[model samples]
Target chain A: MMMFTKPHPAQTIRSSDAVFEVKDLGVAYGRDAASVQVVNDVSLSVGRGEALGVVGESGCGKSQTMLAALGLLPRGGRITSGQVLLEGRNLVDLSPREMRAVRGSGIALISQDALTSLNPAMTIGTQMAEPMIHYGGMSRSAARTRCIELLDLVGIPGAATRLASYPHELSGGMRQRALIAMAISANPKVLIADEPTTALDVTTQSQILRLIDSLRKELGMALILITHDLGVVAGVADRVAVLYAGRVVETAETETLFASPRHPYTKALLDTISQLEDEVSERLNPIPGLPPDPRNPVQGCPFNPRCDYVRDVCRAELPALADSVEGGRHPVRCHVDPFVGLSLTMASGGAR
Target chain B: MSAPAIQLKDVSVRFPIRKGILRRVAGEVHAVDSVSFDIAEGETVGLVGESGSGKSTTGRALIGLAPLAGGTVECFGRDLRALRQAHGALPRMSQIVFQDPYASLNPRMTIGETLKEVLEVHELAKGHDADQRVGRLLDDVGLRRDLAERYPHALSGGQRQRVAIARALAIEPKFIVLDEVVSALDVSIQGQIVNLLQDLQQDRGLTYLFITHDLSIVRHVSHSIVVMYGGQIMEKGPRKSIFSAPLHPYTSALLSAVPVPNPRIERMRPRIDVRSEPPDPSAPLPGCRFQKSCLFATEICRTSRPQLRSMTGRDPDHLAACHHMQEPHVREALSRAAQGAVS
Candidate 1:
């Protein structure tokens, strides 16, 4: 069910060869005196038209990692090490102006908080057209026409008329659509949508998801959908990367990840989703205690304190990503074995 | 007959929208329009709808927070209007939990102070007894007894919400109004709170008016259900009956919109086409509130509002407000809509 843009023909693959290839990236705020590391040695890649999902609880450094990749981290924060390669270009070494060119033209980002991200006074049309004019070098008239087309593509009706409407005039759903349109206006090779449909209603969320799915397919852009909702990820993502305390504990094909979750943390997250109010009111299988505070970082496994099947080795050393039981394409970071804690026992034949 | 815990007989809530400083009555927004339902003792009835569906208004009216413009709200056989006129007790038997936990709880008050205030107002606990009761209530809602000294800002969203629940339970109310209680929480935390509420209801035999837009949660917690649209009850029945075989198009449409976690089911399901946002409550309509968007709506639907009526003998309590409920073609259309929803 998890599909990429390349799988679908007739789509313009923005960069059919390569989209993003990030390696050992790290972000740190302040210098040696008052320094704090937010994002560690993180490495990930997004294929052309592939949707990579980043999931974790709050303060897990999911946002900081992507911000570092985009070179959009806040005032105090800066990438301390590693390179972010987008379509063969290493953006880590780029200057401020060059990074700005790569941001909207090569890769675009849509933040979760639309209210603050959007210009309150500007009309939807003008905001949507800004990228086209600045990045695509389009004329005023051409950009306006493209903006309307982009809005229409995202399922907004009366796009021509609504062009004059301010951000406040549009509903929450409409504002999100306008944001997505602006993100894709430059035909960027990669689109990073951080919790795009988090606050929307179920129906509106579905619509926005479908719109994102269609845009990724049609534009052939690699999509990085950052969210905590497994249901959202289940519907759209091609691959999933589970982050914990600035480190990716697991990464795999969406189906393999959902089917036989290898890491204890991944298993807990999946178990939590099934416990959602689908039929009966079930007690929460809470991952007890808070995520490890970044201020005082842990020495061993980041998830050890909260992980249920922790072993002696788990407390002493960090588990590297290795082949899971199913032998999927990706490796899981765990030592105690996911199925032993899951009680699969081999005879149960894994989950349905 | 079992005494109904809470009953609304043709209940209506109308808020007047003003034009400006001139104070001209622009129009009366029909927040809850002639809605009627009954919740039996020890039963949970979910009132579900979209943002502007008046579900929250209905919940507010039950707890005496919002004024009822017309009809009657009978709580445990006593009419709320009659109680309002007498101006005594102030419905001590009912309490409400608002959507925003931060806004709902007093910022300045500590957890201990807030719960003590509730107990003091009801005169249910005093001195050492009051302190003991506060600790017990906090523990009941999954909060530590030692955390009572902390202010609201010191707590997380889930913890603050638990405090709100503890305060609602402080008065020992028989009925509680939960308005989108878990909507702001993380999914894992939501599951915990939901389970806690269910356990509380079972243990205390408390009646709950669970108002929310989450159909899945409603389907899980509700005993009986009422789907509201444009201030009217579009459908009402037992939870299983309504969710399994919804008669109204709006109910089916709303349920179909929730994304299933299973990839196979999601791929098999068809997308429901619910065009146009919810209508403005201030804009008065003569006929059906959903006529403009309902595909099966006819000319008669646009002329007169349909009264809530029974359409099947299977469940006398199951009712819907649609003229074509008995029509085979309409049934076919609904089935197709459901198919489209899953496809």
Candidate 2:
């Protein structure tokens, strides 16, 4: 209903200054007719020291988009179209060996599960030093010294002794910190954290988020944080992108998105979550149905069935993502303007 | 008023920590220690805590799944142990739905078979009658009766959770231990399950022990709350009082750590400095279990364990285990922290 006119600090960065950008990225699985477009027409960018949050449910292809950018898609999964540009270099065109060289020092990833990510047999020191040695061309002794310093920077206590311990010996929080330290070992220009704190406790989750936020600032690295939790993104992300059915449904500055979400799906998502600051209501207004199965694709807008303000056009034609208001930075993919013709009664009522 | 539906008094649960090749009884790990609470009929008591805080253990102890080392668990004013000894099993009045619906449901069996097995085991119904009852159970949880013929792998996570809830309800239990039931579902689906749980509670007059680490969900569901840490009850009170003005430092810290979905409020909120990790369960400290992580810990907290006591200005039932809960400075600090004011 309203918009914040003030420009955010992250918004001031020009596109030329973007350290990492994914332009109209499309990823698919399987071959020909059997192929399922898991991510389609998705574009995102993060400037130096900026954090862009990609929020979506489990099957929305949030993870697959980043995996494509990393050139680590699973077997049978391939980039269908578009470019993954890291500092004006099109990573999609790079060869396997070249991509490997660009991975650690150019852009690094911190995945959700730390236990499985790190090698069990290898000591923490070994895993941390291997990346530094391979990417930075450092000697073994020097890499070991840097490993301890990185561990200390990520707030692991007794860092020197911890280097000798295995992954299983460390707690969940410590293991995550170790993974983060290793990710930033080569000081990449971009960092991608996918559901980094989903497995952790509330207290430990806060600590991890703070650590990641501070590291992004201190290193001046672009951050692409992918998660399903809005509260997590609210704390760390400067910009927020809401994804649905493998497409970007809405994108805006973090404050603007939360203050006044333009898309029907984004509005519904915000309503479904029970925030700590919100008054506990009698009943939650949950979106009535489940997300569409990607294999069995839906026609027109994928969210049309569940959307409260569904129109005939929404079911007939897919809406391209465009700026909602003239001269407004917020882009929404929807057939109808949610605020237009919205009655107070309809707004208060639950979805049909 | 009427005897509480479930009562736990000074309950303690311990598991042996065997050592060496001989499997000697080296020591014990107190999984639950001296925890006490009451759940009135048709009331929900939220058990909130970090992982390994013994919330699930407390739930298991109530249903006779875990062996109690000390104290008593009573159901409907009768001792649970006595009931178990007389009946050869705990009565069919209580049930539990675990966190992982996928793991809990059997993959080999169809959904129909799963519901039928529960009915047959309890001798609640027979062949034709079981089929009819199974349909109703699915309908009760808002699932299609045709879904009964499908296997667990075919159904979605939310649908599988509904099947799990249906199996729990087939026994016609008046009390259920929902251990992180909605934690596995997406945020939108979580609301659906929570609303379903609330609706079922009203229709059947069910009493629930809703255990979870998510604070907002707990705040929505529970009439009262219990905060546990390191196998001990840190605080217990009406939900309003606990959230509005928490007296225990651990409770305050736990609440503050929960991220608000709004960016403006989240950034302005003052977070209490919670030091290090949770306590080691094997070697719990002598005094306060939360002393190591608490910022306001003093010498008294190091030597003497503070028992749950009600403060002067709060509700009589509102209790906290903190030595300095009544002191002016500590109370002010905790209240300020709970109110999200910069101090």
Candidate 3:
């Protein structure tokens, strides 16, 4: 509770300054023994004009964590524990009606698939204007004019004509831009974009990421970018939290995390990707096994099975997310400090 | 030198756009337009492009899945059309693995049954011999032999993809078309699959048409790269030349757009301003397909389509289609825009 109230003494930006925060949040599906804990003991905070990238693969609880925060978990899903705070208010305990009010006006989400997320039946103008009229108390004509402006802000050319067009009328990139425009219509303090560019081409993906970054700074909103691609996060996020099997394995500044990742899972994930500048190697160093099943619930460190440097202790007991250097902002959830007493190249599974 | 494994000459694939209950042809969507390429024996040709760029359609045309509107496809100097006309069936020498393994696989069939079905249809093996081959195919793809009994639903996405690859290999093909095979898998699993594919290609001496939108992966696997846009070939060259010194503006734009994993380089990189979506294929445009988004587009570019001509000062195989590629200013502008993109 004290961790929630006061800012960390070691950190520059405190939790008190955070526009949105999730403290030790846990989410589960089903009931009793059969229940599956998809997200466990997750703590994250984002301040005004700051972007936090939550990086993880499929079934790593990246989407579940955000869904729990928004009070938008599908049927049978429940927030098992912890608090999601928007400014001063606890969102986990909010009523259904109150949560509805907070959605577009307080925190908005832009999902991965724009086609499905959008209402195919409604015109793009109607969808964009509805939130403005309902939440901002604007007239129909005023809302219509504002929709065009919002569309133009997201780099949609001929915004006025696009408004009257249906969702099917626009291309994939255009539909995504419309979705982003609608999400920011209420000018929420926090924006959660879950895999916004996963379905897009590289060209369109860059454009969307740049737009989101600029908008976050312009509106001074806290941005949570949830994606599986490390490359996408590298450009946008100020800080990153690497997740594995529903737990935060490592957290650090974006540059530090990429330059000197501490955890074995984090290092392995970095090595797996084929970088644009990388000289073609004969083989890629892939993590040995698949991600652990959430339903089965592995003991100790969830990534032990797949970790190249896993020890006996790793399989027996769970490790705390603690900083290797005292008072440092970088925290890693691994018992073995691979970098200790080793050169950076030697520690990174050199020539293996 | 031995003949090329696969040769495509002015290949075009068109799907009719129909209207009304009678389904009259309103127009034609040219999915693949005059796409020509040659894959040398045991070489991997990476066909890269965004959606609706005809990369996938071209892959399908090679395997006889997509009917060709014009031109000839020859495998090992044998005309595919002539072979199919004489035998009443397309040769089984070529195979393809689709992107979504789950959709491509049957829900009711076990992995063993799926592999066995391909053998049975091809008349390659049967009975206990077929069962043994099924296990070997599963092993070849790095899947456990026990997994042959499990259904596709029971397997993970990576495992299902491996099974799909196993089925493709069941026919013992000389050529394979992998259409975004690793696009659906996780990054960690994608590496495993990519490595597996490389190993298989070396072992079997397989000629591969690796079609994907990911530039990084294509650079890793391909000997030569083919850049496509709006269902037309924009550039074709050795992978290193294409990466190091791209002659086409569209190719430079694509190379710039790929986000590097390194934060420092990513932040410093200058993105080429190819901001608009790809040209609509259904409504064919006159002149260069990329003219609308091209940074160096001129009046001539809007009036005449450029042909894929060899670059004078570069590798003989390095070819690009652009009216101003030979001009020093255009080359300097492209290099300036993409200077910070990669290194």
- The candidate that wins on TM-score is 3
Best-first order by TM-score: 3, 2, 1
DockQ of each: 0.44, 0.50, 0.61
B160-231, model 1: which lDDT tens digit per residue?
899999999998899999999988876656767887898899899999999988876787788889999889
For model 1, the stretches where C-alpha displacement exceeds 4 angstroms are A1-18, A28-38, A131-139, A277-290, A296-299, A324-328, A338-351, B120-129, B327-343
lDDT of 2 by residue, B1-343 (tens): 8889999999999999999999999998989999999999999999999898999999999999999999999998889999988989988899999999999999999999999999999999999999999999999999999999999999999999999999999999999999999988888899899889999999999999999998888989998999999999999988888889888998888888888777887888888878988888998898999999988899998999999999996799999999988888887877777877211
Best by lDDT: 2
Worst lDDT 10-window in candidate 1 chain A = A9-18
Q: In model 2, which regions exceed 4 Å deviation?
A: A1-14, A274-281, A324-328, A338-352, B341-343
Q: What lDDT does candidate 3 reach at residue A106?
A: 92
Best DockQ among the predictions, by candidate number: 3
lDDT ranking from best candidate downward: 2, 3, 1
Candidate 3 wrongly placed segments (more than 4 Å): A1-13, A274-281, A338-352
Better of 1 and 2 by TM-score: 2
